[model samples]
Target: MTDSLARMARRWWLALWLAALPALATAWMPVGDPAWPDPQLALVYVERTLKRSDDGLILSAHLALFRSSVYRLTVIDPGADAETPRPTLPESFQQAGSVAGVNGGFFHPDGQPLGLVIAQGRRINRFETTRLLSGVLYSDARGIHLQRRAHFQDQPGIDALVQSGPYLVEHGRAVRGLSTGDPSQRTFVATDWHGHWILGATRTRLTLADLAAALSTPGALTPWPVERAINLDGGSSSGFFFDRGPDVEPVVMRPWKPVRNLIGLTPR
Candidate 1:
């Protein structure tokens, strides 16, 4: 083959490989654990293999680690009116100027956010109690905080908040009594020991107990030890989105249905 023709073929192959790299990297499979000595805006994608008593499952999760000191966490609402079009995860991410995010609390059929929702220091909804909805995630100038609704205090200087439930982890341990056998897609928000935020979701179906175990188990898919975690809306409503940067297209696991609210992480 001529030198120029060979060079052109090489360039074409390189272009194809470059285009396919992100899709391949984001595919569901286990990945090596990453270490972050200093907190910053970073995302690690993992397809974790879980050890269940009945059978194993692959849990696709994106672990986004970011310092609360360097980023702002906020809740986004698409409004309560029925006429307003609900935004998908990617739309909410772009609209909120978020680097990473996940679907927020559960909502009613007409798209009204259930439980409490406070955005940018403004109260959007009041606290409500339900069987499964038990946790609240809020942020203040001090940083992000998670607690059960019964324990959460209405504090000053609060910036954003969302209430969702079935607390997955508390005080660094997995909360007990989660459904261990029923498998379904799941989404969760958590904080590591150092208070760095983590948003994750299973790409495939898995029981809630399995997910809690995976997040709380050290040396698991979760890169850091999870100090606290809570289950968000899952099943058809589960969604996750992360913006790698300007050069790469964002990783978006879209919801099967439109969502009413989202929790977004914006770089500070």
Candidate 2:
């Protein structure tokens, strides 16, 4: 072939590949041990291994990472009335068009959210604070923000909010004075420097302090730097779920009991 013709063909091939990149990145893939379903948003689903402080191992803990800019974060509140019926995570997931979710906040025995529960721009439950429940997770025009309850008050334009936590990580460091013993299944929500959100849970048991340490250490479990982290309701309430679409069955770690609220991720 002539030099000019060869150059033209190469240019055309490059242009075609560039145009196909978006579809290729977002296409569904096999749900193996670690899966990258969405490349453009940098979403991932994987099981990770971590060592406990007492020289034990946490094998196959479920972890997921989703960029805030790519996914909308919202909370699902069953209702404010204690007598109202509550739905399971799978039910809530399908209702909200959520791809993944985890249990949110603590609750009363009668099934009402114990602390503040805000959904769809309205406060459904009143705010309460104790030694363990001190932080609030809320979404507004600026995105999700986590702060101490003492410094936060109900404000306008909040899309969703759930109050829970001992503030696992603060100011890029693991918060001191967390429980070092009495390990149990745990779940947490954390934010990276880029404002991306991470929802993760331990299949194996780990105390509050050990969980924070793993998150703070670079490359310990998460690929991003967790600027702030907060513990959700763990123990019997700890669970994680991800809907991988029609082709692949959903991934779910069932909670021991029905939960009052959940935090979910919806595609933007």
Candidate 3:
């Protein structure tokens, strides 16, 4: 082939490869184990750059894995149900002395909970029946879990809980008809249904449909496929903080606005 023609062909192939990269997927791989120096610790942090199944947009994710047997997960809120503002996730994580933390459920413009919020065993807000309030993440005798609002039977003696979201994933698949147009940074919780759950978020902005699609995709959560997931209050309220130590750089996304509550982990 003529030199110029061969060069043109090579350029065309390069363009095609570049176009395909957006659709290329990456697996959730752990950066380091014990996420801390403790050899006995069970928290495993994982991350990946993956395409949104709904679209080819790329996003990076950070997830902290927790097994109820090894870690204590809690949902916390400032005491008052009125006119409350909160520190950013990183600061709050340090203050709470948790292994990691992410912003919690939705709230009204008046700064009141939109659904149920039981923090530290105190009922901060009563449960409400609403389409958006579809998932409840709480700690009961069985331990921390995610339950569909329709199925959650509130009895007695709960430790912490945060009711949130439109139920992103169910039965190991993304739910149909998640809103797709608006994109923003997201914080979410997902479970494997056997007491293994994840606290995760992406600084990369993504629509709910995109986030749900990514979560349900294989290798997104690593080791455990998502059985169910719930979206925490996102947009400017979305944030996450995982401090490995002063030596290791923490994974964090600071919220631009004051978050209503936090879901965090501590040693079991």
Candidate 4:
């Protein structure tokens, strides 16, 4: 009887310890849905480590969720070589007074934007009907949106917009034809369509198809399920920034090279 009791006790303790391991592992990284943002705050930063279902590879990701009603998304353009000294993402975020930002749009080798870019309610470039330029991230009187190039409408009074992509997610499913090879760093934007949007970047390198599959999976991003997502200018242009506040260190992932435009948030 004594031996049996001891064995039972050992088993119980072992189960308890095993149960605690996952919680202990994700200390800075939350396993479940993180705390929703305070109502008064416009944006909330989230950190998560997601394990891919097939290979069980871990993807460490950073995310920022902002309420659309309280914040207005903008394109912070450095302009057409108008200034001698130009700021990269970190410095641009500092100058614009934005809470969070990510690198935006694709550009040509000569530093010209590849597709439509609107800033401060003016068009910087016109739309291009290329096979790769398949989506648009823009804001208008109806609010922020990620629309397929097929469905997008050219509206007046559009203040902020960037056109770039090969859609990562459409109608909540990963687009089927994304390239599976050439893994690289990535940045993207997703929306729940219930007044919230997210900016995210992968610390781990992944193919576009893998990223699209991971994002379309549930529990990849917290507090809301994604309805739509569009890839931003990734690869070496994959930069991200979020200002936590004065007391906490801000989250910043610098791009490998200089980028032409940035998508950022401003308190309305």
Highest-scoring model, lDDT:
4
Candidate 3 clashes between residue pairs 3 or more apart in a chain or in different chains: none
Score every model by TM-score: 0.80, 0.80, 0.79, 0.83
Compute the lDDT for candidate 3: 0.77
Error of model 3, residue 84, in angstroms: 7.9
Tell me how many clashing residue pairs each candidate has. 0, 0, 0, 0
lDDT per residue as tens, model 4, 100-207: 989899998767898999976878878999988999999876688889898989889788999988888877788998999999888899887778788888888988
Off by over 4 Å in 2: 1-42, 52-54, 80-86
- The alpha-carbon root-mean-square deviation between model 2 and the true structure, to one decimal in Å, is 13.4
lDDT tens digits by residue: candidate 3, 72-142:
77776754444445555676767777888788899887668888888767788789988899888888766
Error of 3 at 125 (Å): 1.6
List per-candidate RMSD values in Å.
14.9, 13.4, 7.8, 8.0
Winner by lDDT between candidate 4 and candidate 3: 4
Error of 1 at 193 (Å): 3.6
Residue pairs clashing, model 1: none
Q: Poorest 10 consecutive residues of model 4 by lDDT? A: 22-31
Clashes of 2: 0
Q: Of the candidates numbered 2 and 4, which has the greater TM-score value?
A: 4
